[model samples]
Target: MPRLFTGLEISAQTGLMLSLLRGGLRGARWIDPENYHITLRFIGDVDDPTADEIADALARIRRDAVEIRVNGLGSFGNGKPHAVWARVEPNRALMELQGEQERILQRLRLPAERRKYIPHVTLARCRSATNQDVARWLSEHGGFQAPAFTAARFVLFSSRSSVGGGPYLVEEAYPLSVAGGLGDDFNADAFAGHDFG
Candidate 1:
């Protein structure tokens, strides 16, 4: 069994910003740039049948694409500072999408997430240390912001451990229809410079 999650990839520019932040932090494990994502739902380890069922459910979710912005940097926990992450600017679209995904899973009796949904993109993982370093980092970098962009789809990813570290393998994708297809006006230029595969 493998752990799975639904999330959207961060843009290249945003990824570069995260990489810079990682370099200055102490006691932090820099996350691979390719692994950066805003997680919607974590399905944990499940059997093949459950994975297939979840995939099927995800495909049935209907929503238009949305513009989400990545803004600010922060750390979690009071003393140890377990994690550092890029905060998502508050957007109803992101929250609604998260809620929809949760409802779909709950219908299948998947256990609820113990923690509340706080939209963020993990930048680093921290181990035993005072949060003083984290506090200073946040204060200095909190104003960081990325260009607002439309996320038209999400992926169901499988993480496999390797000699280097774990790499996220996208097992499936769920497309969001836009107005050109579902109420969103898309700019092909936004994707013109990128190679997804």
Candidate 2:
């Protein structure tokens, strides 16, 4: 069995910027900068057959590369502040890709994701941090923003069954195309600037 999910990898430059927020707050277990990614669908522990089915199904999704921006900071767990994250600015392409992944998993008999999709790159896991601590951290770092980058691919990642901050391994990658495929929206201008030698 493998615990798997699909996500978009961030640029190292973006991850390095996010890494700067690691200290100051107590009880924060910072995720390694290399592990920073925006999760699309979390497909929990699955049999090898199911995993293969998921990998095959995902390869069929073809969307244009999405521009991702980390525009702000936030946390979950209400008063307890269990986690902090660098929020991803949501746009149509990103939402569609995530929704496609969710639908694929559900069609394979995986449970539907109950939470509304909120795209974010988790920064830290809060262990003993209180509401005040998280609030203070957010106040100081709330204006943080990373230079936007276009994601060329989404990946299937495997992880050990443990706490969320991961030592994830990429199992497979699927590229997004500028040239329209199947149901993808066509952009004729995508070819305009290219030098086809």
C-alpha TM-score for every candidate:
0.86, 0.89
RMSD of 1: 4.9
True-structure lDDT of candidate 2: 0.84
Question: Candidate 1, residue 128: CA error in Å?
Answer: 3.5
Clashes of each: 6, 0
List model 2 lDDT by residue over 1-197, tens digit each.
Answer: 88899998887788989998889998999899989999999888988888888888887897888878889999999558899999999999999999988888889999999999999999999999989989999999999999988787788888999757799988877777644442122233332221111
Clash pairs, candidate 2, are none
**Clash count, predicted structure 2:** 0
* Candidate 2 accuracy as TM-score: 0.89
Clashes of 1: 6
Local distance difference test, each candidate: 0.76, 0.84
The sequence of per-residue lDDT tens digits that candidate 1 reaches over residues 64-165 is 776779888887896579888998876887888889999999998999888989989888777644688788778888888887867887778777533222
Q: What is the lDDT for 77 in model 1?
A: 90
| lDDT score for residue 82 of model 1 | 88
